[model samples]
Structure formats: C-alpha cells, structure tokens
Target: MPQLAEKVPPSVAGAVLRAVFALPDPVRRLIAGRAVVRDGQRLALDAQLLLLMTRLEGASLTGATVPEARQGLARGQRYINRLPERPVRTRDLAAADGIPARLYEPKGLAEGSPLLVFFHGGGWVIGDIESHDSVCRYLAVNAEVRVLSVDYRLAPEHRFPAAADDALAAYAWAVENAAALGASPEAVAVGGDSAGGNLAAVVGAFADRRPDFALLFYPATDMSVRRRSRELFADGFYLTDADMVWFSDHYCPDVERRTDPKASPLLADDLSGFPATYLVTAGFDPLRDEGEAFGERLREAGVRVAVRRQEDLIHGFANMWGLGGRFQEALAEAAGALRTGLL
Candidate 1:
C-alpha cells in the first residue's frame, strides 16, 4: 500500500451539489432537462452535474475558434488545479525531442523506484501539463511510482504524429535517464488518458526497447474506424462526437493518415507480444467502446491485458479525481492496478 495518498473530501459543498443535481426527473426537466440527456439513460449524474456547472460558468466550446477554445479550457484547468495540492515533489524538463514535461515524485519514493511516463488527454488539442497536475500527483503518491507528464504538441498547431512522436520520445527519454531521476530503467511504464492514452498505445507497439507495462484510460484506439460508442454517447456527455470530429480534423488533416497504425493503434496489423497492459473505460464515454476494443485486440493477440470499465462515469473521470466521490475511489483503484502491474 502507498504510504501517503490523499482522497478528495466529500464535504458539505459536494453533498449539496449532488442532492440538487441528482434531483428527480421532473425537477431536472424544469431546470436544464432535455438539454443534457439522451435516450433517457439519464447520463451519469456526476457528469450531467458538471455540465450544468460548466454551462453556468460559460464553458461551452462548440464552434469556438481555436484560440478561444484553447484559452477557455486552459482557464478552467488552471482553476481546478489551483486548489492546494498534496506534498509531492515536482520538476520540469525538456524531452530529447524538445517537448516540455513535468515530473512528479512522491515524498516516499526510494531511489530506483517504478516510473510511469504519462501523456495528458485533450483530444490531441487542448490539454497541458498543468491541466493534469492533480492526476499525476494522485497517481505518483497512490501508485507509489514517479510520474513524468509529457506536454506533447497539440493539433492544428502541430498535426498528426506530432503528439505521437513526442510521447514515444518522452518514454525513451524516461528509460534512458531513469537513474538520474531516481527511477529504475527496467521498471518504467508508459501511460496516458484519452489522446494521451492513444499515444501510449502507439508507443506500446514499438519493437524497440518497450516499457515494462502500458496503462491507458479511455483511449481512442481507433481514429479512422468509428465504433458504437461514437454513435451511442455522441451527445450531452462531456466529450461529444462533434468534438471528436473537430479533433480528428485538426490532428490528422488527411483522412488516409488517420488509418495509419501510428495514428490509430487499433488498426495496427498485429499486436502480438506487447507488454502487460491495463486499460480503463467509462460506460458513458464516447470513447468507451474503442478503448475496450483495443484491450480486447491486445488480449486476442496473446498479450497480457487487464481492462476495467467505470460503468457509472464519463469520458474524463480518470483526470477528475479531485472532484471527489466515486471518481476519487476509481482513481485510487487505478493507482493500485498500476502498482500491481509495475511492481
């Protein structure tokens, strides 16, 4: 067990919010009903609640210009990470590929400890190291492993394979310079969430010195092929199909390139002998089906794969642990998986 891990507190504020947001259908309908529901599945209560909060805070990005969207997301991310954090030691570095990154080391980690090189999720476009700081800190502390969060180049500004290439390079760098950061080269793992998760899977395919394990959270395994989740949870949820389409267009301008194995690991011809892997998906996430598909393919290819579906969550639950409730518990479970897989 990790020596010093923290969980988001379920205070009075959270209780009030849930009690209000999780109100009866008739009451919700009178408030913001049909606007955020689909097929009467009721959407995840936490997700719908957050959407209502975001809408109130002016967080819609649909049809927003690139600059406007980036700024808006960055602002919200900054606010979320603004709360005081746990006492994990952190530092910044530039990968050999010149991509920026942040490293988080739990106060209790000994020399030559396990390391997870992580990539942040934003559909290959709008996330940064700062945005994912809380998640990294939580993982580093709870998993009892150091986390190196890579700030890969985003879409439109830097297109297809740019983020992929950077993720790979960061993984390589983490392996090469492990001892310098008090980590073990042989214990390094590659992981990410969403676009970052996609990048992690891409890196997982490399025949060259591969990481000991791979961890992906709701990754977009198939960029070119649309799965059932794409149609199923296309709207009202946190990550909409329209946003996916926009992200794909910006990241891979050429439709053909999106099918390339490097861009979509799910389309890879073979995935045999890949390292031990852990994949997580959210039931209500638009990318849920694709994430599970990747894990299933890897298992079928004879690789050791472990998959977990957060059946009551949304697209970005892995990164929202700080929001409290079940999200924090889910993240803690994921960290336990990370430790078990790596150690």
Candidate 2:
C-alpha cells in the first residue's frame, strides 16, 4: 500500500503546487524565510520555496523504513515531475542479464542517433524507472537521442556492487544493441543522477568497453570520505546526513569495503581513458565537493571534462522539471551538452 502522501492525486497536487508557486516572488521569499547563503552561493528562490514546502508538509526520508522511503519518493516524483508529451516512442526491453529496461526514442530521429544508458537515482536503494521516467523523456526529446533507462537492482536486497554491476551490464547492452535500437553503436553515453550518477561514473571508470560520453549529475564519488559539502549541507538540504547513513548502510554495509574503487569510483587509480564528460553538481548538495573533486581528477587524468555547478539548486533538481524554473534551465544545459558531446 502507498503512504498517505502517495494517496494524493497527482493532478490535485500539481494544481496546488502551481498555485503556490504562482505567488509573487516577494511573497514566496517571505514564506520561505530569509535567504540561505552558504559557501558563497544563495539558494535560488524557487528551490527555497520547495524546501520550505517540503518541510511544512513534514515529509522526510531520514527515518522511514525502506518501503516507506520508496513510497515517499514515488509520491514526490508524481507531484514534481511533469512528463513530456512529445512524440517519443517508448518500449519495454530487457537489458543484459535480463534486467528490466525502458527505451525512449524520439520521433523522426536519424537512423544513427545517440543513445544514453541512464540509471535512476535513489541512493541505490529506492528509486526505479518510474520515478525517473520524465527525466529520460525530457533528455530524449531535448537531446535528440534515444535513452535506455535501466531498472537496476537496489540495495539491502542486492547490496554493494550489485547496482554498479547492473549499471555496467545495462550500458554494455545499450552499446551492443544500439544499432538495433536505431542508435549509433559508436555513440552510446552513460548517465544518471545522485546514486545513478555514482553508478554511471563507476561504469565509465571500470567498464571494459568504454562509453563514448558520460553525463553525471552530482554523483557520489568518494563515499568513504566526509567532505566539506557534506558538512555544510548535511541537514535540511533534501539529502541529509541521516539519509546518507541510511543509504550507505543499506547499499554498502561493510565499512571496510567502502574504499574499494568499484564502490567509491573517485578512489579509482586510473581515470585516464574515460570519455568526454559533463558533470553537474548542486551547490547546496552534500555531494557537491566530492563530485567536483572527481571532475578535477578526471581532468588531471587527461579525460575531457566539463563541470557545471548549479549553485542555486539542490541535490534532486534533475527530477524537479515540473516546477519549470531553474530546474528545467539546468537540465536544458545538460541536454545541450549531451547533444554536442555525442555529435
């Protein structure tokens, strides 16, 4: 059964949200309280209002059971993610090792369009294809490429390395079957947000057959370290420290194993041959510093890297397209990067 929040109809929720956000900027700012300034970045007004609304609703992922957390995220996605009704065709497919996957192909794409193998973010524990359906759709239509959204196995049930293994397998499957999917075999990219971003980076770092490009959105690179951003945005920033502990506990229970390169790809020895990459980090996200550090490491290793810091956004802004503010703007830049990189 779904939670009470999940019971709210998406239409009703959407209407309420649209009305609330339609409030004047000054009113919204007043309601959201004073400006949140940290690390020399002011949180965007829209993001501030969203955070305030989330808190007002008393919703949180920190203390929920696994099922409850998943339900909460499902409800949130339903409320905030507006699916694009563009002429993209979707088909269910099985990825490598029979993992469930969905392919999003925009209408009238060229025979050799690029394909992005995307993993949905949920700390490797909660998220699935449905939670990120709109993200793939937006990317497909805007980037003018097909997207393979991989439903990778989650944590507690699958544990450390399972999600990474599945991500690599799914990406490999996309690369191998690109032509069949009407995608160019040589132009497959790997991407994801948050935990999905971590998995994408892992695939880029360790896969036998390299991806042509990598699009990472605030990936959790060095899971073993407690970085400055983690301390700065540890609480009230959507992804709290308690939430991280919960996710890490479920995904990688063995403290000793957290340092493994496959588990913490930032610790990987060689990032030399990684494909051209665009890594985006949220200014207010706990993972921001580490993600930027990974981009620096990639650059140092001779990988072509572009790192964009959406300083006004939060960790999960990639899924906030329904809000139609800075979230959509940030995503549009990312899509443009993908289109250019794959060309």
Highest TM-score: give the candidate number: 2
> 1-343, model 1: which lDDT tens digit per residue?
2111012232433454556655775685566555444434445555666667655544543346787667656655543442325579989989767888888988767999999999988888888898788888888988889899999999898998888888888888888999998999989998899999999998899737887998889999888888888898887667899989988898998998888988999989989957899899988888998899999999999999999988768888876675665677788888888999997
The digit string of per-residue lDDT tens for model 2 on 1-343 reads 5444556686787688878898988888888899999989999999998888787666786445788789888877887767676787899989899999999988887889889999999999998999999999999999999999999999899998999889888888888889999999989999999999999999999889999999999999987999998899999989988898899999999999999988899999999988899999999999999999999999999999999999999999989977888989999999999999998
Counted clashes in each candidate structure: 0, 0
Reference-based lDDT, residue 13, model 1:
36
- Which residue runs of candidate 1 sit more than 4 Å off their true CA positions? 1-43, 61-63, 82-86
* lDDT of candidate model 2 versus the reference: 0.90
lDDT of 2 at 100: 99
Which pairs of residues have clashing backbones in candidate 2? none
- lDDT of model 1 at residue 285? 82
